[model samples]
Target: MVYPEQQLSERQRYYNAKEIAQYYRSRPWVVIWRALTIVWLFARFVLGLKLDEWFNRAELNKFKRAGQLRQILTDLGPTFIKVGQALSTRPDLVRKDFLEELIKLQDQLPPFDNALAFSIIEEELGRTVATMYRQISPDPIAAASLGQVYHAFLTTGEEVAVKVQRPNLLVSIKLDLYLMRWAAGWLSPWLPLNLGHDLTLIVDEFGTKLFEEIDYINEGRNAEKFAKNFRDDPTVKVPLIYWQYTSTRVITLEWIHGLKLTDTERIRAAGLETDAVIKTGVISGLRQLLEHGFFHADPHPGNLFALADGRMAYIDFGMMDQLAQPTKEAIASAVVHLINRDYVELAAIFVELGFLTPDTDIMPIVPAIESVLGEAIGESVGEFNFRTITDKFSELMYDYPFRVPAKFALIIRSLVTQEGLALTLNPNFKIVEVSYPYVARRLLTGESPEMRRRLIDVLFKNGKLRWDRLENMIAIARSDQQFDLLPTAQLGLQYLLSEEGKFLRRQLLLALTEDDRLHTQELQRLWDLVKDDLEPKRLFDVALSSLRVVSTEGIAAILPTANTINSL
Candidate 1:
């Protein structure tokens, strides 16, 4: 049965294994030609490298070979370009020299014909450029694998960026995916792959995301949702989408005027602080992972800009991902487990997060994880960074049954690219230094039940309060300027009197009466740690103000304990 173009496009939004297989099966010539071309390129590069190694010849230097690899991917078109971009962030999979070259794939690509691009825009929007736009660039301002963007102004004098998708993107992407899936099936058996999962699943995941990215309608919606997630955040910016001019092949968004985040010289010339820009990127990135659970999966330097007013602007929302609530909580818990040096729980978390099968024995893997992560975290958390941990974990993946879950592929890419961006601005920048403070503040002040439970887990163990852990968490959280002391205290008091905190209350009472006497030493230690921040005048004002929000019964429930503490 024949289908309309719109219906076909809608049906193609997701990966359909059966449909893809059948479609490619009917195009044997196309597959054969593409396969031959790809194999030829690989043979040329691999043979050259082998010869260089055998003869100790400096003919093809690492930089030259890396450039050739980039050229091959670019020549092969968008699909291979996307794969190159993914590899650019994986230090374990690609060499540093090649990675440096592959990084250019993020934004540096040859533009398609300008005339064809304009025609596509006119065809999609159902109007000539003269009528639709007051002024538009004669050539694309920027060209990417899937699309090229033009700076344009609407007839009503509003500035916008017109992004026109490459000609026949779907056809090219489909053919490439089919060939990739086919190649993976044959290559997996011979390749020295230690990944615990099937290779095709990774291909399928990439295919699905690629399809979504090529859909401008979907990307526009992603932008709107991302903007809403950060509506209250003053430090972040998202371009406004113009739905009237957007389609599956075309998207017009507000033109963002800012400096590329990696351009340190220009940023400094504009009187912007590079350090503050890095902090903004890290904190906003954390919120996306831990709080909203929706994040931009690709945050290369080209996508993030530093605004004139110091806000960080995020553009190009084509690649975004969402985490299930359980997944999100498990990740936050995993961070706490790592900080506490609880490798056993950390191993279990890896299993839960799909890095290992549930049936796999974690006992042997626990020490391996600890040795790798412990060395990466060395002396203090400040020294820890994603790149180091990722490199270490890559080694573990070879030795253990660890695998990169298909779901977490983009998450890793997003994080590594973000760190790469930061490093370009400040060589001394460590992501953990900025990220830990945000995580600590969330654990301390997060109002969700899941976060509250995590907080309790961090603060207590074996039915006793760990005063030292609490003090450490507070000290770390205090480093974040956004951490509000009074609100957190009031939230803590309210939770202590609520139904959810019954377990915590019982645990507290048990610790207090364990020796058949008041255990005031821990309490005194806590008070001393926070005395300066919670001085008498501030405490009194907070108490008086908190009364309006706290129910009388809730206050009554905690009054006896308060009186006992006062007497002490």
Candidate 2:
């Protein structure tokens, strides 16, 4: 449902901390650190603390600390619950125990007063509940941090879920958000995260996303986009939004009666094959990430259901991801190179995709990849082990200078998350085997053409042929570039072209030792005398010497031009 006309009231949507204090009843510090406090409890889970019978009473209290959080969010209502939903999917952000508890929040909240619910329905839809549904469930079928769902049938005869926003939810959210924002301001001088990257940015991001979730209009449009992306694929289901019955605070959708993908008992009882279910879900997730580029980011167990017909249903598009065209191609290409066992290419793609700096040295990360990957590149993904991949790579990227791309963070979460669900279903699903063929085909048959070309251009222009890159390097050098590329890459390449150029100096020294023939290993080996950072240019001299050679390794010596990559 598109509600271009339904705008939130000024007072409901906007308020300062002073204005908000009355409703939420906490100082800014209490409300904001509540987030940090929840994060600390989440840390216990990530650190693998035994919160069950093995944990000490005080240590076991971590469970209560986390549980108390779930209770508080329920008390806070819609905005916080929505916040919880977003937090649940962020593996790159929250720790595992927190993910477990946050996910446990699927349908656990005190229902809003039925009388008040009806009154709000009347006020929102401008119609009575009886007119909308023949019979509305007094008890909500499910409740969460956000809103509760009531099973109903339209008077015209359709089973639907009526999601109602908590009464006075806007007032509470605005006040809590104001307090959180102010607390961040007050705490900035004292906290490491507050100054550069910390709780403040997190709260602000959480607050913004929380408000976005409250906007039924945003979810409506996100759902519409998903339905359109999969219009041709019926195996995956997203409930059709009934716009006429929708408003800023209320959303109505076709009711789906199926076991959530994580519910093993209900699924097994319904006589479905768990392995096939796992395959379809993972494959479809791949399609969403690679083919369509727009996907439901929060496809946690609660949001995915296994239908009677053996199809997986994806719902709850409150948090979704959209990759830019260039980003999509870069990721797709990276996948292909990874499958083909081209570590250098994979490293290069990282730079192309803006995942790392253009001048960043990837040689350091290569051994880590080899250490993690070894010779197991083509094995069936069903048999691939996720623990080995994650454990070895946990600090891999962190070893190099990098920041997680917002999109990649969510996408990685999606894959690792489905792996968790896969453990429940098949317990042996290796995602890589599935991912390999998809990537292999892309590399063999030109999967992401633009990205491939961009990568090739980058590798050739700057990587193998240092002398040829003089033009590109010259532009950066001549322009007074600001990035780290200037002092290192541009300067290094600048020296390679001049009489003082490292490559020329090295080559002249080597060729002076022996009459150098162009484009041979002996020539490159001799040139290596200069230095490895300057080693890439030696290969370029080979390419320029007009040797009729076409080795793939030889061609790979080049690096891509990046001044124009940002446009993508």
Candidate 3:
């Protein structure tokens, strides 16, 4: 099971910005000419719009201007197209009209020459096309900014997709990045941009990720890693990478047969429940972000398919990102803070996560954060969606000192694109409604020590138990079909009996006693909630299974108490 990355050289395995800069520096004329053309194009459309605004001329149709901008990016080539796709998710930077148009950049770009694409595949793979594939599409089935995918069948009669990268893609992208980084330095002082972070750093961050995307070998490895992560999940599917035929410039993957998640009519006709599809997407997405931390950053409709068997298939693993352990914990905690409507703590988390500068006064920003998030969430979590929240938060960012960290750019893009896809399938889809159950289940299960601490923070305050929170978490967690009653109960019992549970034990004891008397009312309420799920047979089975993990002495110690309970 040697990975594709292991076959590549050191230079091919990672993005080397300095090497790219040096390579392009030897060809200065290429950069200068391209930079001039880009400047002219922007001056004609972007600067022209600003000029029109300053002179207070007749108002032009914003939608029309946005279309022109999209066309300009399309003409500019792959690098600009990628930038447009990134901007499509940034409601904070781009206006509504432009954002709508930039969304087209995801998969709507025109294809390159078919003959050239075919020739490149042959050259890169070092094989004649007729020998390698039994059949290949005469034209690309789908065209994206970086590459176009051709549906083909291997000589072995297996259906596959052959992806061919654009001609001179690295040369074009390198020149563009170098020029953009150079320009960011010169323009930062004069431009009226209010982004708190340095403009050049953003360009570098985008450059790093863009470099990662062009290496088809890296993408093959990404697909494998992602597949390994979801190995146990039956509801989600990742395309198998044909590593034998994969190279730096071309990749072959299992051709998925399904309708796009956005194709509602066909999806419903296939007898797939739209809500169930959305649930799978949301839950799988939560696992990627909150659990595995390695996530598919680009989840556009074109990259996601709804299979006939009701599984959601994710393709295009080139644009993926990972989160560190601390970052994962911070995100989970942020969700809790948001649910609690604790804006002050939420603002602090934002600062800690680099969304705000340390010197920024959070006190003045707290109420504004509350107002935006509160209005979106209101009394019902069902009302919340990423688009609505981002739109409002965009305004807040404009008025306040908040900034979008470069690392989080793809994160926001992934979430917003997912919600948009969900909305396309079911107009009434509420992401928060589907998301909270997964988060609640994760908190309740307490998979890690940090998570257990978070659960405790949510369940107790001032040395007192919050029975309502515990009950509500259970209610929400049970809604997930994957939630297992016996395992969760066993984990809870094990933790309660451990040394780390000393504080919780004291708190529970205190909670069960009042005025020198024991109160069974809360205990009875909890039992009533769990009784249906914990049938006698299930309990007996769980007890029998527990014998493997529990020592005989441990069981003997608890037997007398169990006998007393049976007698009662």
Candidate 4:
């Protein structure tokens, strides 16, 4: 029952592939030129492939070398540009100079034909452009590597933005990616040194994300999900999708009017508070990573906006990252441990989160964690710079078995980009400090009873409540509009009476009173608090058992001084 149109479509695809293959076949000389250039550059810059010892005449500067590579990738076109951008995010895989250069690879490629864009819109929607939009701008508003966006108005008088795919983009990208894979296969075995990642691995990862980025349907869905996630939040805005006009090759969305986040002067002139805007951006970013578990992976300044009403609007949902429930919970737990500087528990959480293998030798990893943590903490307890610590940790683990999970890599990149943007707005802004309240709120108000109990464990040690720490946590939680203490406290108290909690309490008491004289008063206080909850006989039996164990070590004086169980 195939119609003539369907038959023609199939035949067109066949020709497209054949044409692409032929196009690549005609480009062997280009490939050889690029490959040889890359080989020479890599050898000279990375491997020190110098001609003569006497001609040591000042090796080419690293930044200059990166510039040369950028030129080569730029000349090779879209696929290489995408690869360079991906490499820019992996500071652990490349030198800082090269990373700096690669990050500057703008997607501002030259635009294709306006006729082609309008024709694609018409063909994909099965409607005439004249009927679809009352007025459509002939010139594109923005042009990038994959596609271009145009300003248009629907017949219903609603202003909208139309994103049109470039003509034969898939075919061109397919050919480029095919050659990339072929090159990766050819060069992988002969690579002189490990660049921290193989070409095959990088190409495959880039190809998947690249393909996903070009799917307008997926992009529309991503926008809808983001809108759903933040529907109730007044400070955040997600674009409204115009499904009546959206398809794989073309998507339409409500046009948002706002100033670029980088335009601090204009944002301020519009009566928006810069600090408040940055705070909202950071908090929303945190919520995406920690609470929602789905986040916009590419959060550069260009993609974010500050509306007239002070709300932050995020556009371009092509790149998004998701964290699983276990990973999110582990991250929340890690935040708590990190704040407390509990390196041991942090190490365990790292393994539990799959940051390291289950059998990873914790002994070797712990010191590395300690060194990074200690350096970040510096001379003060409250001073925590997340970016510095994360960078140091990445460097420390570069050569080791340590690997950042795929989702985590995006998370890191997004947060780093976010913080960088915030700093550009205000140089004195401290992202870690600004983010602490959000982190504390998530840890203290989590739904899990275990998480609440862990909060208690963190707030107390050796039967003494860390009042200062508890107060700081409360202050931070209060800053969050969503934080509620009553329910969290109730859940924590219920957990305290459970068998697991009781065992943990006993262990804490034993560990505290084992050899320290400082807990003499705290132990009595803690006993008075817990004695009513336990049967008198059973409580006395437990106390007496502990006493016998302590008496054998001749530290009986450090035990509770109450004469009778009644006094306790």
Scored by lDDT, the top model is 1
Q: Lowest-scoring 10 consecutive residues by lDDT in candidate 3?
A: 559-568
Counted clashes in each candidate structure:
0, 18, 0, 0
Q: Tell me the alpha-carbon RMSD of every candidate.
A: 3.4, 13.3, 4.4, 10.0
Off by over 4 Å in 2: 1-4, 9-103, 171-207, 372-391, 442-448, 451-568
lDDT of 4 at 525: 57
- In model 1, what is the error at residue 299, expressed in angstroms? 1.0
Reference-based TM-score, model 4 = 0.72
After superposition, candidate 4 runs with Cα above 4 Å error:
1-75, 83-108, 175-203, 380-383, 453-472, 478-568
Cα-based TM-score, every candidate: 0.93, 0.66, 0.86, 0.72
In order, candidate lDDTs are: 0.83, 0.61, 0.81, 0.69
Ranking by TM-score: 1, 3, 4, 2
RMSD of 2: 13.3
Q: Write the per-residue lDDT of candidate 4 for residues 1-568, one digit (tens) a residue.
A: 1111221243333323345446667888865665676566556654432432245632555556677677666655666666666565445467777766775664444678999899989888889999999999988987665678899999999999899987766665766766666776788556443332345555555565666677777778889889999999999999998888887778899999988776789998999888899888998998888778899877765478899998999988877867777667777767767776778878888788757778888877787788777687666434665566776776655555565554565677787778767765776676766677777876666566555556666777666666456666766665656665544444443443444355545454544555543455655654554344456666556555534443332333223322322242
List model 1 lDDT by residue over 1-568, tens digit each. 2211332355677778679889889889989999999999999999989988988864558899999999999999999998787677565568888988897887778999999999998888888989989999999998888999999999989999999999878888888999988877888776444563567887887888888899888888899899999999999999998877877788999999999876799999999888999999999998899999999987877788999899999998888999987787788778777876888888988999998889999998898999989888888878878888887888886678777888798788888888888877887788888887778778888669988887787777777777677777787777777777778887876677766666777678767766677768877877876787887888888777767677778667766766655664
Q: At residue 20, what lDDT does model 2 achieve?
A: 57
What shift in Å separates residue 190 of candidate 1 from its native position after superposition?
5.5
